[model samples]
Target: MAPSWVNDRSYYQEDCPIYFATDFRQIRNSLSHADYRRINGGNRITLSEFYKQYHKYIMLLYQNGRELWSIQNIEKIDLGDVTEFNRMIFE
Candidate 1:
């Protein structure tokens, strides 16, 4: 399956956070607390089922993670590039 981040050739578009964050929360909870359920809604799904749903989007998650890492490690904040920065963040 195609990665989820590329919606209309852009990132941070439709369903971006949900496509990654929900699965991350589910897996994190499963590993840390043995809470294999929907993180927000209290619905339950087996780990296998969660894996089936999540497997396809792994690349999406990885790409977003890398983007976040790059942003976090920035050495300087150039005010001149505010527009680009805003697009990177708020878009």
Candidate 2:
């Protein structure tokens, strides 16, 4: 099956966070802890570990609606595993 988080073009305009809910919370930053929690509600990712390699011009966003935080990248790092993505953001 296709990647669950790989929503098609239509998903782009979704204002609700549930569309990306499963994945976004996995990478949420502590700087946005409260806002993330508020936006995410108690509907957090309860699934087993899964990861994606996100190489963006920015950290873009990992929140629900309006972005709670933003990170610009002058450098890009690709972690082949989701666990690495976790470490890169949290550590």
Candidate 3:
């Protein structure tokens, strides 16, 4: 089954991954603070089960991180607007 979060249909935008990161953080907190069970649409799952369910999204986030890290020659990269650049990179 496809991941529940992929419904957004905004893959390449900065907001898409930001939403995924926030949702993943929430899942992490729920697992940590609530008996190690992930709460998903009223369905509770163990850590391993959670990983199986979200493996695709997890891998996508990992790949995005790798791509971000692969950026070289930061000074040579031209960002037209500092605010937009910060929003894209930091927000």
Candidate 4:
């Protein structure tokens, strides 16, 4: 029985455990209040939008010491496939 947080959602599938580290304050300070609201309080943005806004912070697996199966590109990522690959590698 997986936890509720483990369930799939429109934003991201839970099968792959995504991880990222960033300076929240820096990101927040860079955005205007309205921009923040548009990103965080409105309908989800498309993959193109995501790449445009966050590509600088993106990192794929093994980049910057990230573990295997890490995802950097949101536009072409398949979380389910990443999860299965991770399971095969670790098991």
Candidate 5:
């Protein structure tokens, strides 16, 4: 079964489009406290937990529409080792 947030269309509308984050940690940190409360019931959670809960909806919009795509799948990666590989190569 899909998560409740996936079925809840209230967060996705013409004026309030869903935001996508390629790096789950960055996006999770970017969310305002109110957003966290609204979507996550005010419980503090790790980025992996957040991604496990929301990645489906993010992927849905990414594959179907203009929303940005984040990591294809959530896997265990060392937070300290995460660097912008693209920037190093492209810059």
Candidate 6:
């Protein structure tokens, strides 16, 4: 069956992967704080990489409308407005 995170719409390409991530657990796991930064954090996405895979970049926010994580096609982005766009999505 398709992943529960994915709905019946093509929000992503054909079958983009879904991720359920957390910050507290990462801290407990001794992961670097950089990776755990909020979705609005700086360098959330790479310009060069995004341009290279411009056809596969999509982001989804979840969980109390707090988290912002990338989904499939996560390399392409014509829109450079991460904060504005994300705010719109989560707001």
Strongest candidate by TM-score: 3
**Which candidate gets the maximum lDDT versus the true structure?**
3
| Collision count for each candidate, in order | 0, 0, 0, 0, 1, 5
Per-residue alpha-carbon lDDT of candidate 2 for residues 1-91, written as tens digits (9 for 90 to 100): 5555554554444454343543554545422554454443345542222133231101235343233223334135444564455456755
What local distance difference test score does each model get? 0.57, 0.40, 0.58, 0.45, 0.50, 0.40
- 1-91 per-residue lDDT for model 1 (tens digits): 5455444345433364354566666666766784524344356545666666665466567777787646543445555675467557754
**Cα-based RMSD of the predictions, in order?**
8.8, 13.5, 8.7, 14.9, 12.5, 15.8
lDDT score, candidate 4, position 81: 72
Candidate 3 regions with alpha-carbon error over 4 angstroms: 1-26, 31-43, 80-91
| Model 1 residue 25 distance off true place after TM-score fit, in angstroms | 3.1
TM-score of each: 0.38, 0.20, 0.45, 0.24, 0.26, 0.17
- Cα lDDT tens digits, model 3, 1-91, are 6566654546433433344555566667775675434534244344565565565678677888898756665556666674356456743
- The full ranking of all candidates by lDDT, starting with the best, is 3, 1, 5, 4, 2, 6
Clashing pairs in 1: none
Q: C-alpha displacement of 73 in model 5, angstroms?
A: 32
lDDT of 4 by residue, 1-91 (tens): 6455433343342233332233333344435444644445344443455555544345332354464445444445457876567656655
Candidate 6 — which residues are off by over 4 angstroms? 1-8, 11-13, 17-46, 51-58, 62-91
**How far is 11's C-alpha from truth in model 4 (Å)?**
27
**lDDT tens string, model 6, 7-81?**
534645454333212322333243344454333334343334333343233333333244334333434544567
* By TM-score: ranked, best first: 3, 1, 5, 4, 2, 6
Error of 2 at 87 (Å): 25
Candidate 6 lands at a TM-score of 0.17
Residue pairs in candidate 6 whose N, alpha carbon or C atoms collide under 3 angstroms: 50-75, 54-76, 56-73, 56-74, 57-73
Model 5 segments beyond 4 Å from truth? 1-44, 66-91
